[model samples]
Target chain A: MTVSSDTSMIHAVGLRKSFGSKSGETVEAVCGIDVDVRRGESFGFLGPNGAGKSSTMRMIAAVSPISGGSLRILGMDPATQGPQIRARIGVCPQEDTLDTELNVRDNLYIYGRYFGLPRAEVRSRTDELLEFVQLTEKAKAKVEDLSGGMKRRLTIARSLINKPDLLLLDEPTTGLDPQARHVVWDRLFRLKQQGVTLVLTTHYMDEAEQLCDRLVVMDKGVIAAEGSPLELIRAYSTREVVELRFGIGEHEEIAPKVEDLAERVEVLPDRLLLYSSDGEETLAKVHERGLDPIASLVRRSTLEDVFLRLTGRTLVD
Target chain B: MSSTADDGSGALPGTLIRATWVTDYWLTVYKRTWKGTVISSFVTPLLYIVAMGVLLGGFIKGDPAKLEGATSYLSFVAPGMVAAQAMTTVFGEVTYPVMGMIKWHRTYFGMIATPLGIPEVILAHLGFVLFRVATVCAVFLLVMTPFGVFESLGGVVIAFFAQLLIGMAFAVPIYAFTVGLKDESAFALVFRLGMIPMFLFSGAFFPVSNLDAPMEAFAKVTPLWHGVDLTRMLTVGNIDGPMVLVHVVYLSALVVLGWFWAVRRLTRRLTD
Candidate 1:
């Protein structure tokens, strides 16, 4: 195994990926991009659907080949040392690829065995992971019998069987309930506290704000912005946001009336978002104009506003 | 327990024992489901021998010359049944299970995501199939012994090895084909169009010399034909030097060619 002198957990330069269509056209999935994930940091890729987040994660996992440029994981080149790179990283793919034929504990055991771990060592680790995922009671249950959240947790636990240095999670909490998502976030937070370098991709702004120490916002196969949640908000968004609902289709008409009250007015289908330094003062000014129609609330600026300001579109939409 | 102790800095390339972990997985599954597999592997073959060799041999009144110097039809068809059983079991094991692991259950995808590469996955699975063939052939040989078909135990052992060779000769290519398939519909056609015809015309039930000229020539070139011939020779203690070498070389060549093709196809399909 060849190790590089670079200290970054993951390092890439001008990475690109393209797929060939039947008519000889090429679709560039991941356009040229540069990324560096430092050790012991939870780095995130925040993007919408079909934004090439999963493709980039797959390349980092060493399962998919890099079309051009360079990628190094755990200081090893993925092109020549893929298996060695894969040996050191744990990947939780967007889809749960757990073996349905095996029980919960066996899933971890078999994956550990694939990494050539000793039987006794795998046994102990399986028990520990099952408990860590809060599935010790369901350890013997078949994988298909678990709920969606439980299965996702098991996939995360399975990825940890080899105790990899870097963990790649693709939409880890997607399709999960609020409580289940929180549970997953709590486990991930603990892993981060233990100094596991985490790399994840998600479209949920809250998930990104809660878990990522640093992140890059991607759109149309390119990095649009990159920073910590607070830094990105401070750089691109106002101090507070006022959400005002005038009527069903009256947001367009009310946007101009309140356009002068805030730094910027964004008209939406059902609401008008007024970006201002003091949202309460902006709301008082709106009420003084006799533009009251339905509802109004002032909240602190978040990553969602930052994403909208960068991409000119909402995160989920 | 806060931090992971394994940095994986000392990871080495995959070895033979690590590859066998795939075989170990199959063995563990078999531990739970072996009872279900016993009938097809043992009982069905035993019934075929009883019906075709014992009861039918008793009904046929033929001269030893016409029966290829055999004293009875029971001894004549026993080795043929052994060879055919190996082919059927090995083919059955590789077909749906291989496809399910690729398309349906996606277990092979799960395996490749780990440190194991595509070659190790293919080798380990084929190795497990070989283990199954050996076990099934051993049981078939024991069942044949009680029926008074074998001339000696040493000869029975030799015939067993021949059956394994024939099974692998067919298995590796079929495995390569299964990896390229998108669905299981083609498996039915393989059984009906390919395996059935070969099973019937490969001189398993009668001598190829009794067949018409072109048909007999076609049968002579089949892997199962060589397998049946070698197995029958070993069963009756009638070993021939030149023909044994010819059969061994032909089957071994198929195994080598099929193995190379399987590795190439599987690596392409799994890796990208």
Candidate 2:
């Protein structure tokens, strides 16, 4: 709620991270990358596995030291003013590190005390967060008893205890069921409506599309592409995407003949994707080829289209 | 990012102190896990004393008793009990507990994230461990006293202080090892190789001279040997100034070395 000026919430330039292996080989987790997260915007890092999303998230959270870069959080250097910057930031890490020893309410209470909150204020806020997360009845229960979705929700509630100016969530709903995922997304959307700055990393293109105001797709520790989801879809893809599937090996024989029907054509292992501004026209042209595919579906261009256009595969790989 | 103006709160004098306060908050974790700490520090030592000193005391002769310069076996064994108790209590309190915080629980990471530096974490953790060791040692001393082990009031006090010193000495190396512990094997090695020999050969049950020549020499060089000697001297009122000097010097050296290593390791781990 306390918006301290409209300055950029987080900024980093030429950030890099590398870990030395036992064989004296150094694995570059994050190559030189620049990023800026302005106030009141949902930012996202969308990438496949081992694309350095976690390494970047760790550096931004001030939990891991940068190898070679200048980084700032709330306009303060994380290298020097990590404590000050962290004081106002909430980070929900990729892996849940919730204290299992304490009850759900105590978990919030103890974490709030870590931020030096008055004990009375912490108690009041814990009550509020439990209600917000719809966990009022389960506040006295141990963390180990909670389901995966419930634990994730508790973690999100714990992060909001200090009412942090900036919130960082790494894959916020990676392993949740669809209903649970929607519930998390709904809560995050509400936080965003209140103008909280959110930075999230995810492999789900659908998640990025749903949450991010702006996103950067990364590959092999480098940014492959960056833009708003809609902007990316428009810039990198057509207005519609047609997926054509044939009976097993039939795709190979018919795929090469359907290339001229769309603006761009991609022959995948299981299917063929035809990109065109008009889906009906492309499908009519495909019908004119005198070949029948097992199945075909035309959908509007999405962030997944952008991902496929840039990385030559889906984001979930 | 604002590249020029500085807030300047980073240099606050109370920052480290506040961080220690935050790190101290983790002691609440013990409210749920006090059983582990109790069993290792107090229960294990009590069992050792009861099984070795009480149960076996009737079977062994108490004359010149192989432990030279001792009037009775019980007197010698009693002082040795204090030293042994101190080493185990201190070692158990600091080693696995500190390592659990660092690697297993990752509680230090949570602490460091909240403006608490690694040194504050170290200091707070050590302070808590030492306080716990002192309390457990006191309780052990009192418990043994009812069994007629504490001959003089001064003996009880000497045994307490001796345990504190030896426990601290063992804690120093354990703290140093904790920073480098990549896995549980390292601590297993500490218990098996480092502490087991010190327990058996460092004049805990019998006098060091009773051991074969090389074994006695090895025991003489150990911190626990000096601790036992100092405690025994104080208990029997045959105090030697040089022996006290050796205990102080050895323990002081270990403390300095361990603290320096821990600080260096933590700074590197935090900053790097």
Candidate 3:
């Protein structure tokens, strides 16, 4: 199978993945979906857990076989040319698979050697990667001793050892703290600046907004929406959201009173989100209705609101 | 740092020599912990020879013909110890380390993400296991020299090769089993039921011929029995041409079969 060289970095048409359980039942993890990721673009799969983001990432990484449909990575068929495709792409799996037995520096060096990199080149690259991840001081420390953020950085550094043209990150900062997430985000932004085409899966709408040039919102094994973060928000949500929290079960009662205050009012369990062009105006109307709330805030709409609008559920829940 | 544009046509060098990098990774890891393993590889085997071969051989007053025609029991059991030690060493290498690489540390996942494929990963790990078996056998032979177990230097050299074959024969299948396992419970069962019986009944401590009809026949079918017999023949200079051929073929077949299953299983597990 020959693929055109000038094609997108990742191109898929109606791709699918189904897993067979021991009880002879089939679970369709990813039902047919189409996606295209161009060169130097940070593409994202944004969804909640079990939304087939990981399944799709695995197929693109050439580690998992696609059950159906056509897929090409680096202009090569992943099914027939897994090694060749893998040689040019970096995969940072969701979980940290760092070698705990080796120190931080050796982890990078050994992984580089696996790619048949020259010894001197691997040595120098290991040094540079340690610095790139801001782990130069911890280069000699064992991987098990590093914090979660450091391990994620080392994993990213290990992925870049071969200087891949396309990088795949599966939830790059899932379990990280806010500060750690920003650190990882900064490093990823730098990689994108270097023109590495990145394809990442993230449930964090903020991560998708901060890093992705284009993204698809997936739910229940299919794409519900796709566009740039701004496009997604503009299409599915209002410019701003007025968040009003009443007493525990008072949101349902309060939502009706504020119904005409915005274009739409979504009554969630703990809070009522009012979708409107002007959040402050919506909040003023909510107060004018004589309905009091425990707390109220006006903020610009984000991808989270887009996800909620499209799926009728929050990104995390 | 170099921003060389990838043309999407460059291929990885998927050569055998590149697989040695996995072995190199293990060797580098071993360098840090070799001191801890030295005692088990060398001293423990030495202690076994002294305790079982020397101290216990003192009590077994038997005719040379009955004790495999050897003049002393120490010489009789020394080669068996070499084969047993090889089995133990290779078993250790293939079990927890293999499982750890797959499930715990996920080192194999990390390797497959690179240009290294499943076959290369399996071969490289087996290569490292062979190195470990060689080291353990060398140390065991060196320790045995003080006890005058060597009939001839060439005989001892052949015994070393026999130990290597025995180790590989056992390492590959156990590696396959290890990769399939989700937990370490089966490993304990393997040690208790499989390894212990083979160590005791496979002519490692005494001639299997001394057992009853059914038991002796059972021992003959075991891979370690072939290993022990081959090493004993080489160490004792009682080289039997046809029997030697039989032992080598049996061990070689096991190694080949084990390799086939291991590679297939590991590829399935690592890829999908």
Candidate 4:
């Protein structure tokens, strides 16, 4: 990605982050990498834990120092102008660092006050944000009294106190239940519609596919593949994957017989996956080979398939 | 930021104003929890004044030198109580709250996520501790006025400032130590080993002259002793300029040193 000051929200070249472990060894969290996020775009970092997504997010948020390489956020160098950069960007951290000392409303108000927002502005913005996150009824409630999903909403509202241009959410709905996740996703979707630039990291393929306009699949502190969810699935995996589960311990034995039946065959412990553009043709070929399968199913390729194809590992360990 | 930031252009430039904002956060939070602290800062110390200074002073009849240049034991012990209260209040504030900010709740991480730096967070939290000490000392002075413990109004005024310094002497350095802490376990040892001994033997209730050489020397090196000595001298109108200078310089240096140390520790802990 070329560095452009005007349209670029985030531009990085060979960015790296290294941490000193307790055992006195240098642990490279993020190896040298390049990333660029344009204005109003939703970018995702799809990787498992220890994949350096959080380190990259921290460096981009201007909270963590860049260990090496040059990076810019909103066209400002984070090393030299961290405060000025932070003043403009909203950060929803992985853990909800909500002010347990204050009520839901005061949490938003005090955060705005930290930005030197005027009293009237903070008050009105606090009200507006509470309503936006659907926490107006719980405005006077203590932070500890709120549910897990409510705390996350309050954190998102607090981050938006400054009306930031770029919003950095680190696994926004990570610990949330399915219903809570949908609530957060809906709120985030609205934020995207309002044209707030979002940078998020998640191992959830559905989350990345639903939220991201473009994404990078990271593995072992480096980006393995970078593209849209559809593009990644198209590039790295077949159009569809056919799952055929045989009798007990028949997958490995049946894999060799079905090797020429489809474009590719993956033998797992309980099932054999045949990858091809046409899953029905592959299944028909399997039957023509006199392969009797107890169960069979077909599904369109997803980002998980792309990840499994690229890294040969599951997204969640 | 564009429309409402006109008033944010404060008298000073940008650096100190942000610190005040962080301090403002403490003040706002303190508003909710201030009621719980009254007994410790005000009621308990005042109770000690009634129990030890007034009740015990009536029994020391034969000794004039034992009063330590004061007309009564109440007057002698009153200023000492003020300074000791500062140390207790500030030490209490800095220990668990500092640990809570750093480790338990990670409130400091929340602050640093904004434009507020680590230095501002440390300074503002310490400022809030000093504010608590000032209020506790001031209220102590106000209520103790009825007892006729203060020898001079001017002396009480100076002692008030001395208590602030003493409070910070404990607060800033302890803050430096606690801001990097991982848990509240070390605080039990600090209270048992550091706070309890200093409160008792820092010439607060009794004169250090009555203490042995090693014990008195230990008391002299503590910030609480300097606070008690300086505050006592000012409250009794027995001003010792050189000794007061020693106390002032010592506490002030500790305050600055502690502040810088806390900043360094917080910087290391919060940043990469």
Candidate 4 backbone clash number: 0
Instruction: Score chain B of candidate 4 by TM-score.
Output: 0.92
Query: Candidate 1: DockQ?
Result: 0.35
lDDT of 4 by residue, B96-172 (tens): 87888777787888888777777667768877887888889899999799999888889888878888888888888
* lDDT by candidate, in order shown: 0.85, 0.78, 0.87, 0.85
CAPRI tier for the interface of model 2: acceptable
* Model 2 lDDT, residue A302, Cα: 84
Best by lDDT: 3
Please give, for residues A214-272, the per-residue lDDT of candidate 4 as tens digits.
99988888999999899898898899999999999877877889888777777767788
lDDT of 1 at B186: 95
Docking class of 1: acceptable
The global Cα lDDT (0 to 1) of model 4 is 0.85
Q: Between 1 and 4, whose DockQ is larger?
A: 4
lDDT of 2 by residue, B117-170 (tens): 566677777776677768777877776676665557976696687777777787
Chain B, per-candidate TM-score: 0.92, 0.85, 0.94, 0.92
What TM-score do all the candidates reach, one by one?
A: 0.90, 0.89, 0.94, 0.94
Ten-residue stretch with the least lDDT total in model 3 chain B: B1-10
Stretch of 10 with least lDDT, candidate 4 chain B:
B1-10
Q: Candidate 3, residues A1-317: lDDT per residue as tens digits?
A: 23476648999999999988779999999999999998899999989999999989989998889999999987888777776787788989988889786889989988887777778988998999999999999999999999999999999999999898899999999899999999999999999999999999998878898999999999999999999999888999999999998899888877778788899988889899999999988888778878788899999999988888888887776
Model 3: residues >4 Å from true position, as ranges? Answer: A1-3, B1-15
